[model samples]
Target: MDKRRVVVTGVGAVTPLGNDAETTWNNLITGVSGIGPLTRVNADDFPAKVAAEVKEFDPTDFMEKKDARKMDRFAQFAVAASIMAVKDSGLDINEENSEQVGVWIGSGIGGMETFENQYQNFLNKGYRRVSPFFVPMLIPDMAAGQVSITLGARGVNSCTVTACATGTNSIGDAFKVIQRGDALAMVTGGAEAPITNMSVAGFCANTALSTNPDPKTACRPFDADRDGFILGEGAGIVVLEELEHALARGAHIYAEIVGYGSTGDAYHITAPAPGGEGGARAMKMAINDGGLKPEEIDYINAHGTSTAYNDKFETAAIKEIFADHATRLAISSTKSMTGHLLGAAGGIEAIISVLSIKEGIIPPTINYVTSDPECDLDYVPNEARKQDVTAAMSNSLGFGGHNATIVFKKYN
Candidate 1:
């Protein structure tokens, strides 16, 4: 059987920049920094003093009060974003079509706050003090599960947990599901609420997070003075529909998801492979999967985590894959503004990539200054660029050597 074409119809997000997709994209293009003083957990207790946290979010806005209570913050984010995405897509899930709809949301870390609270309760009180919802809330797959339950999507409910690449991998898998004719539409992306004490301490212990106190200038990806990534939390969700299915309903198509590539470094656990060999392969595979030449890609939403190795190695990977065309590609990391949304990074970044093709504007890598010799690509720095982006690619590299890339093309 031939593979069906897939297109992104709708997108939604709850991020440090805003509560919805458009707001986040606006902030991203305007070069706004969403990082602020870490308040979710006491800042003084940890070396990382700043974070990109979702502010003024009330779960009741998206779900019922009773249902929201049963879910952790991460699940709440997933449900909120999913509800928004489904509404945006106008894909009604009735009894006849419910089985044709699916959900695949992922998280790098799920319910860290819930785990900490439940463990403290167990230690202080007894086993009975633990809530029955603890187990469901603590697991990483619960975000996908809860979104499916809330949205009444009965087909292919699943999750992918590849650290920071969770969002991209989940979306890629969902694209495959639709291409294979298993589902007509899928609500897929990633979510995380990892601002809890344990998550902060773990990253700090590994020296993976920036110790910079000023939130405005902390996450400066590809900059010479960059320290490390800023911890962040939020969710990003998108509604992907088969081309004929979407056209039949007259749904607004954002961009066509033409290719997906996933690879593993297998060289390290926390560090990327030497010279980003795995990343270069993933990019090559994605371009080949799309049957496009390297020069056809107009923009790249890079997984520039601002960490020393990540920025340098990702630059190397781009050069290795694109060669002369690398210099012409307008690569930018929205992580500079949104911080590192961990697993949800790819989800929001994918949304941004689609928007870039649709709007003909590339979002900038804000906070970039003092360029590094190792990273000498044209990072649309500090300000958004107006360009006719025909095709865009988003890259996500996770801690466990997981590398995923998804390509989006302007729908004709």
Candidate 2:
């Protein structure tokens, strides 16, 4: 059977650069750096002092003060962004068709703040001092559950937890649900709030975070002399609707979700597979799913985490998958500005892909001072470029060897 068409009707994000889609897109195009000295917590003693933190965020603006107090920061961000995304979609579902609407959002590490605080309370005042809401606040599925509750969506609610690939997998799974006639509309995306002390300490212990003192140059994706990724905190949510449902309601279309592919390398826990073979398979599968030739894809929103291995391996994967078309593709790693949002990387990057299709411009991979010989692709380095993007692809490779790719196309 032929698959039903799906379209992105709405987008919402709370990023290190800015909150909301417009501001994030603007900052991304202008090559702004969201990373800075860690102000959310005392990072003076930590090895990595810089991070891409969301600024001026008030949960009260999106939720009741009392309610926001109860929820963890990740859940708060998920609920808030979902509200914005649903509003953007303009799909005012009542009790009549509410069952057709679903929610699928993900996070890599759920409620790190909650875990830290509660664990600290346990350590200080014993186990009796732990809050009753501990379990509710700390589960990875809370983001999806809370968003569903907030929107009263009852259809096919689920969460995907593939480490950094969580967000992309969630969105891609939701897309398949609509395509398979499982649901007509889905609120799908990723949220992350893992900037806690434990998270920092863990990443630092693994040497996964950048120790650069300068925020602007911390996340240098594909650049020579890159150290590691800069942790970013935020949420990105998108409203996806079945084509007929969206057209019937006259919802504005940002872009069409044409293809999605996911694979696992079964390699190391923290590193990508050698040569990114798993990632290449996912890319090829996405292209095949789109029913388009590799040459038709004009841009690639790389999962360039600014880490030495990820940049080199991802570049190799693109070369292997696209071959000569890799040379023509305007590849870029917007992580230069947004840093690594972990699970939310795929969601925001997918939004960036849609925006590129809608705006006909590609965001740059900033801080590309010296190029790596191994990464020889046209990275669209350091500056945004204007081009007619007919089709675009976004890649997300997670810890535990998970890799996912989704393809988007400009609607005719």
The digit string of per-residue lDDT tens for model 1 on 1-412 reads: 7889999998999999999998999998999999999999999899999999999999999888999988999999999999999898888898999999999999998889999999999999999999999999999899999988888889999999999999999999999999999999999999999999999999999999999999989999999999999998899999999999999999999999998999999999999999999988999999998889999999999999999999999999999999999999999999999999998999999999999999999999988879899999999999999999999999999999999999999898
Position 141, candidate 2: lDDT: 92
- In order of appearance, the predictions have TM-scores of 0.99, 0.99
TM-score, cand. 1 vs. native: 0.99
Candidate 2: worst 10 consecutive residues by lDDT?
Answer: 36-45
Residue pairs in collision within model 2: none
- Could you tally the backbone clashes for each prediction? 0, 0
Range of the 10 consecutive residues with the lowest summed lDDT in candidate 1: 144-153
lDDT of candidate 2 over 1-412, digit per residue (tens): 9899999999999999888888999999998888888977788769998998999999988878988877899889898888988898898877988999999999999999999999999999999999999999999899999888878999999989999898889999999999999999999999999999989999999999999989878889998889999999899999999999999989999999999999999889999999999999999999999899999999999999989999999999999988888898999999999989999999999999999999999999999999789988999999999999999999999999999999999986
